[model samples]
Each structure stands twice: as C-alpha cells, then as structure tokens.
Target: MTKISQLDANDGRAELMTDEDVIARIFDHIDNGTTDRGQSSWKEPAVNYQSVDRLDAELALLRHRWIVFCPSSTLEKSGDYIARDAAGIPLIVVRGSDGEVRAFRNACRHRGVQVAKDEGCTSVFVCPYHGWSYGTDGSLRSVPNGDGFPGLEKETRGLVRVDCLEQAGLIFVRQNAGADRSESVPDMPDLIPDSFRVVKSEAMEIEANWKLHLESALEGYHIRSTHQTTFFPVQYDNLTVVEAFGENSRIAFPYQAIERLRGRPKTDWSANGRITYVYHLFPNVIISTFPDCMQVVVIEPLGLERTRQHMFLLTDCAEGGEVLEAVFKGQEFAAKGAIEDRDVVMSAQRGLKSGANDFLEFGLFESAIGRFHTVLKREIEIPAF
Candidate 1:
C-alpha cells in the first residue's frame, strides 16, 4: 500500500491526505484487490448499546471533553446565539457585544427555566416562564417586580458559565463547569471555512444508540448493499483510504470518476468532486464532504435507545441557478443514503434486544469502527476531572 503521513511534524497540525495521495492509495487497493484492514476482528458486547447505566457514563464523559457544537458561521453577528441541549447539558452559545464568543447554562437563576429557545439573534434572553432577562454576555440584566424580592443582587445571580473555544470555523464547548480553561484542543482538521455558508440546518431523532449513527460513517463495506441506488454507482463498493491521526480518523470514499486521474499530472488533481471524505472528529461528530456541499453531523444521546443528530449542510457556491440546484441535489442524495443507513442501524438496535448473540462482531474491513471503540473504552475508563 502507498500511504502518506497525514500530519505535519513541524507544527504538529493534522492535515488531510492530498488528492494525488488519495488517488494513489485507491489505485493501489484496486490493483491488489484489498481495502484497509486491522490486524484482527473484535467483538463488542451488546449490553453497551442497550444499558441505561452505560448511556449515563457516556453522557458524563461528553461533558468533560471538547466536542464540536456547531459551525461558527451559525452565529455571524455579535448578538447571534444558539441554545440547545448537548449530551443532556442545556447550553447557550452566544456572541457577546464585546465581539467575543461565550457559553453559559441556558437555565435561568430564578425557577430554573430555560432563558432561551432554539436559535436567533437576541440582545437579551428572556425566560418565557417569568420574563427574567439576561444579556448576551450572560449577565443578569434585570428582574421583574423589584420590590417582591429584597436584597436580590443581580451581580451574584448571573448565569453560570461553561468553557468555550472556537477555532477552524467551528465552535466547541465543554459542559463541565470546573473543567480546565486551557487552550488545548484535539488534532482537528480544517473542515469548515469562512467561505462556507449554512444552506440548511435540521435535527433528527434516531431510535438507536448515538454510536450506531457514527459507526455508519466509518466504513464503505456497506456501500453496495446499503446504498446501492444512492451511492454505489458513483463510489466503489469496498474501496477506501483510511488514515488515523491521534484519536481522529478520515475515511475517504473515492468516486469512480477518480479513474480519470490514472495518468494525469499530480498538479492537475483536485478532490472537489472526485471523492468524499468523512472526518471522524473523535467522540461524537462527523464532518463529511460531498460534491456540492459539506455536511457536519453531531450525534447526541437522548437515552439508552434514543439519539439526536444535528445536521448542517454548508456550501460555498453562489445563490440560485444550476449551481445552487446541484447543491440541493447533492444534499438530497446524501439524505437518501443516510436513510438507508438509518434503517439498517435501527434493525441492528432491534437485534440487541433479541439476545441472539452476546457480542456483535466487527470484521477487518471495519477497522475504523474498531478504532473508535478502542478510543472510547480508553476515554471512558480514564477519570474526568
């Protein structure tokens, strides 16, 4: 196999494999009748996917680590904000008037009600239950009926703060209030950029474990059987370039069109429409590239058997006409393939209840999934302070 180092040692930055490098690996696999593989197959117990205690442990771990919450472009203006639940932690990420990004507990100090709902531009977040207002900076701006409460110092009643960091055009948050407020981040690739604009944003509730949805994006073994009508014709059945950096990994699903570069100059190779790269940003996020748009999917566990997936489709193309139409078409195609994966995962979730097997086996072709589980086990066993 022809593999290239994906990390720059000089600055220790994680970079994607070049288009030419990716093409070479794809060709190498095609000629050798082989795909990326691990040393041995692994079996994961089914109880992890159906245990409430296990779900709680995973949720607690999510609060301690830096997880991608949303794209930075989602909050363009100073007052723009997004309030939602991240792994059961209610958080509001807002751009303060001082032009700095901050995150706080969405709950109001009075009556423990949420101060904001959904997302929008707001100078003040007012609790719908009692009209308690808070500034974008999360200060306790004012409280109604001043005389009803004596010695209610607003300064001491401000919203509790959470750790927040924004880099590479994405926003990340640590829900742990006592978490170290350092600048350390994971080995993340530059997926989002300022030029990319969010064209669609939506949330989905999946009746399966959050990991199930993430496992769907880590391999091309199911492309032919699962995405026959949607992705098989354009992509290879089991050909992929799998590379890992730290705890993160990128699974490249090259399009059949890449064959055109067989004899072309390396300078002429561009990845734009010739391949799809699914970047697993560790833990719970997958940033994938399509021919027309880039999709960021964040998976959140709702319960033992439920999960919430937040999807953002972004594009750098101009608005309207054939170009815009192609973007929509690409989005539709990706959505269809997602539905196919959803159905299969849901079936697997159902199988967990049948007790047909104590453990679910993963083959060598599913090496990325195996790596994910390995990292997850190590993280879960480590103490979170």
Candidate 2:
C-alpha cells in the first residue's frame, strides 16, 4: 500500500532510462523471465479437469506453452501501460517509455506485492509495496536505503520480464506450464496469412471451465440449435479445422456473403447466415476474426464458468468507402450470432459441472471440438518435467 517515494529516501539521483534501454528491456523480459518461481497460482487453468479424456484436457493445456507469465502482451492500444504484478497469478503486460512492450510480475521483488493494480501505465513503475522503483525498461533504477541488502544487484534485481512476440497483429507470450518450456510456436503464423491483423479485441467472461467454453468455440455444430433466434435460419455448415496441435486446433469457416441477407436490420442480419473464418488458438486464446470482414477473440476463462471474448470490427473498405448497408448488416448479424453463443457456452458449462452429465458426445460434423480435447490430453498429463 505504500508508494515508491516512501522507499526512495535517496530519490535525488534516479535518472530516466533511454529509449534504446526500453527496447532492450522488452527482449530481456522474454529471455530471462522463464526462470521458474516456487509459487504461482493455477487453480483454474484453461484445461478441463473433471473429464476422463486426457486428450480434451491436454488440447486446452497446449496454449500454456507460449505464455510468458506476467510482464507479457503489453496492452498498447490503451496507451503505454502495464498490469501491476503477478500476485502469484500470471497477467501483467506493460509498455516501456520507448513504446515497446514489456510484461512484469506486477510484483515487487522486495516485498512480493503487486506494483500495478488492475490496469495502469507509468513511465517508471515504482512498486507501491516499497520504494523499489523500476524504469519502463525493467531496470531497478531507484531503491531507497542503498546501504541495506549488501551485494544486492540493483540492475539485475529489477522485476523479471517474460518472453513475448508480436506477430500477425497478435502478441504471443511464452510459458513452461510447470515443466520445461516448449521450443516452437506450433507454426501458428504459417496457418494465418500476412493479410490478417487484429483490428480490435475485447474480453468476455462465461460460466464454465476454460476447456468447456473452448469446446463450444471449437465447433459451430450447435449454431442453429443453440442460437435459434440469432442464427437459426443461417446455413449451419458445421466447423472445420485448419490446424491441429498437441494441445490446440485452428478452425476456420466460410461465413455466408454479406449481400445474401436481404430483409433485416444490421444488428439482426446474423440470422441471414454467412460463412466465417474462425481461429481457435491452442489453450486459452481464440483469434476468431474474419479478416476485413469480422474480428473477435474470446477467452473462455476468467473464473469458474466465466469467460471473456475480445471482440473487434474489421474492414477492407476505407473510411467513407462505398459499401451497401446490407453488407454492414451482415457483419452486424454475425456479431449478434456470437452473443447467442455465449449463452449456450455458459449453459453447456453448467451441464458439465452437474453430476447428471457423464460426457457430452460431439456430433460427427463437430469432431474438431473432440480433437481439441485429444490435444489437451497429450500436453497436460505428460511427466516430462
């Protein structure tokens, strides 16, 4: 609860770091933060725990391989800012003064208290827990009572940085998942083209285990039946997988054309039915954006039965570019349809948690969702550690 000033009793000489230092700090966070800490929380990871199908669980667990933990995925769109500390839970993402990304544990190395709370950014992140202050570059530039803790490496003791990558307009963070780290990124970039970019994103929470919500996202088999009012009339062509990994599957669909839906408001046109390209990243993230057509990324876990979807609106047509209202409506309808999905995903989670359901079967066309589970089993239960 204390501010950095309180600890920086000799705060007179703390100078600001250079922009190049910030960039170097960005890479440093990625390479060095991998060192395992003894205590981190994982009570509700994205994997499904109750199911006997180790495959299902491992498929969800695979995404954890790339998580850099804490100081990764700096949210720049919100302006240069970072998530405070890990608090024993992974999720700090900060932007250095130079505008490069850096993620931290949100925890102060000294007292282990979170430096950033909720979401906020600062040029120099000073831990409120004590006077330990770090520049945007992750250097322990200032610390009060320099005489204490003899031999303490001020420069080396700054908060740890997690490994991260920004590709295809998306950020990837590396993680070990309680074991040794995974070497490659499963060739995710190859599956998607350079033409695609994350236009925008929002996180939505749903009720259910992370895996359960992911299962629902993996397949669109329940599209017609689950989203009756929103997409009942649209042709539910089933889901297709473009890539499958040890614990992840990438699926894409051809949503119906924008012009096809004739008589409807933009918001309700989702009922017109259209083809869509949806990508289900392994483990926790889903990049289900329809390039220039639609953009969305949904997270299936926040808490138990809680998931968040990062929604974005994309377009090839420039601002003021000529496009029919019907076309716009198609995208609108598509978003409406996804809202319907949240309800079904949440409901499915409730059913699974109930003892009444042993194991819900995936229809033939909805097989990718099952394959997603198969991948989960491979990654999570292994004892490679």
Candidate 3:
C-alpha cells in the first residue's frame, strides 16, 4: 500500500520513494504474491489494430500533439542536428548558434526532396540534390542557380518551420503544419538530469503495431513468460508500481538487488541502479532509467502493423571512465531485454492476423496500458476545430 508520494521530496524534484520504502513494498509483494492493481479490467477491440480508419485517427492525434523528437543532449553542440520522420513528416531538429533548439520540415524548398539525412554537426545544411544551403536557424543562406528563377524570394522561401519545445532536457516537436502555437502542451516530468549525454543512438523498424510496442513497455506482466531468459532471472515478474501523471505514467520495476537495501538507513539509500523507471509519455515516447544509464525510445508508426523505434543510450557525461564503463554494461543488459520484448510483440502482431480473438483483454496488472488506451480514445473522439 506504500506509494512513492510518501517518500521525502528533494528541492525542485519529483518525490521519489527511498530505497528502504521500496524494499518494504517488494517484501510485501513477495509475501502476498500480488502487485499494484487497477480498479477494473479493459477489453480492447482487435479492429483498433487492423482498421486503417483507426490508424488514421491515431495518426491525426499524434500530428497535433507534442511528441518527443530527441533528448537535448543529442543536440548539445550549437550546430548539431537530427533528421528523422515524426509520424509521417520528415523533421530536422537543430540547435542554433545561440543554443536554442528548433525543428523544421526537412524538405528542400526548391524541390520536395529531404535536405538532411541522419545526424551530424554542421554550420550550414547543403541540399544534396541541388546546392541550396540553409543556416542553423533555418534561414536560406545560398542558392546555386539563383538566376534560373528570377521571381524566387530567398527570404520567404526558407525551410518551413515546425512547432518545437524543449523542456526537462528533452526536445519535442509537433508535426502539424498549422497546429495552434498557443495550444496547451502536456507537461513532462524531470526524468533525466541535465548532465546526461547521448552515448549511442539506434534506429530500427519493427514489424508490430506501435501500440503493441507501448503496451510491452508499460507493464511487467510479461517478464516471467516473455522475458524469462533475459530479465526474469534478475527481476521479479508481474510486480510493478504504477503512478499516473496527467496523460502520462511511470512504472517502477525493481531489481533483485533491491533486497540489499532492506536494513540500510533511509538517508543513505538511493534508487539509482536498484530500480528501472519507465516513463511513458503520453502517445508514444518511452524514457527508461536504469542505475547507470537512461534510454529514450520514440515509437513512430510507419503503418498499422509497422513502427520505427528511435533508441538513444544516455549517461552522465561528467562521470569518470569507471562510471561510464558501468553505465555501458547496464545498457547492454537492458538492450538484451529490449530485443526479447521485440520478438514477443512481433509474434503477437502475427497472431492477431489469425482472427483468433475479437478483443484483447488487459488484466489489472496491465493498468498502465489501459490508461494509455483511454487517453488515445479520448483524443481521437475530440472534434476537429
């Protein structure tokens, strides 16, 4: 019955349970063989996964919402830029010389081709198709054949800007071209510190519905069965502490090592490395924190049955080499569990095609997934203004 809210709060930081408090809960769950549960079960229709209309509706909501683009550390340098697809729009998030982050449509104004590909540092972006160049602030700087089009207005023909916001050390972008600038954005909790730096980044397309990937991330019910070989040995199965924050939620998965803090003094305890904190940002961002490192996973829907995962490995850059080595080791362990989860979701996607069940039933332990579906349903039902 203990919650993180009971833990002492740090100045200007979210309240978190001390190691002693969390250890007590772990023991309680072990004895009772029960985890945090929801008030009721949820039944989700299969059409939500197979219907093109449903997918379109979900995409519409995502377009207007502030989805995570990347971590602020990814654009640490003044000219660093990351080019990727958000929902379906090709977006380029770049840091200007003034240390401000901005996002814009990646397409070149001359033609419809993308101007930037992948990520790198550059003072100016030169289009590979033509010689059109743009500054870090997204202003047109040069054009090769300027005289070819006499009526071309360089000032107004710069890159099309997208709505961008940076908060809590994360970068977010709204893909809707005409989205209201004054629209209220969901507040993001401080999940990672400013000192964290992106140590590695990976991009891959998964053969599963984006929701399926999110469901896998939101609960620990599948650890014993799905991740038995990878995670179950070191982590308890079907045990988690879920806390809701607006449209988002945080699921705490404790490691077996948490037992070591049972008799430790409360003031001397830390949750770092002893618990895996998975923050599910409304819609499609997953920020997972381990003792040594943090990861940001952006789930972008490619189609009804396909999704692109942008994974970034982050660690405290100010730490020493030994600390970094431990962080990298922890990241590898997490990566293994991720691979196992991917395989399970891909299998579920294939099974859904068999028309075996009309709906998928989510139990109480999977409450976070139910909460996500509720938010998605509410957003889709909103009338367009």
TM-scores of all predicted structures: 0.94, 0.66, 0.92
Name the runs in model 2 displaced over 4 angstroms: 1-64, 67-79, 82-88, 97-100, 118-121, 145-151, 177-184, 190-200, 237-248, 258-274, 291-293, 296-304, 308-332
Per-candidate alpha-carbon RMSD to the true structure: 4.1, 16.5, 4.8
Against the correct fold, how does model 1 do in TM-score?
A: 0.94
Q: Per-residue lDDT tens digits of candidate 2, residues 1-385?
A: 1112111111132322232332233233333532111122122323244544543344334334563222123254433563522212444666665666655555688878766665565667677866788776677888788788889888778887766555544555543344445444544444334433333334455666666666666665566677777655643334332334333444444333443443444444441124344555555566544424545453534444444544544443343335334446666776687667766777767666665645565555555565554444444555452
Per-residue lDDT of candidate 1, residues 1-385 (tens digit): 1112232211232555787888788889988988877666668888888788878888887887788899888887999998999989899999988888899988999989999889999899988888889999889988889778799989989998888888888999988734456575657667776678777899999998888878989999999999999899988998888877777888899898888888888898878888899988878999999876799889999987788999988888565467668988888888999999999988888888889989888888887788778777766776554
* 1 versus 2: better lDDT goes to: 1
Model 2 compared with the native: what TM-score? 0.66
**Candidate number of the best TM-score:** 1
Question: What's the lDDT for candidate 2?
Answer: 0.49
Report the C-alpha lDDT of model 3 over 55-151, residue by residue, as the tens digit.
9888887887778889889898999999988888888999999999899999889896888889999999899988899998999999997899898
User: How big is the positional error of residue 368 in model 2, measured in Å on the Cα after superposition?
Assistant: 0.9
Whole-model lDDT per candidate: 0.83, 0.49, 0.83
Q: Which candidate, 2 or 3, would have the higher lDDT against the true structure?
A: 3
Candidate 1 runs further than 4 Å off: 1-16, 177-181, 317-322
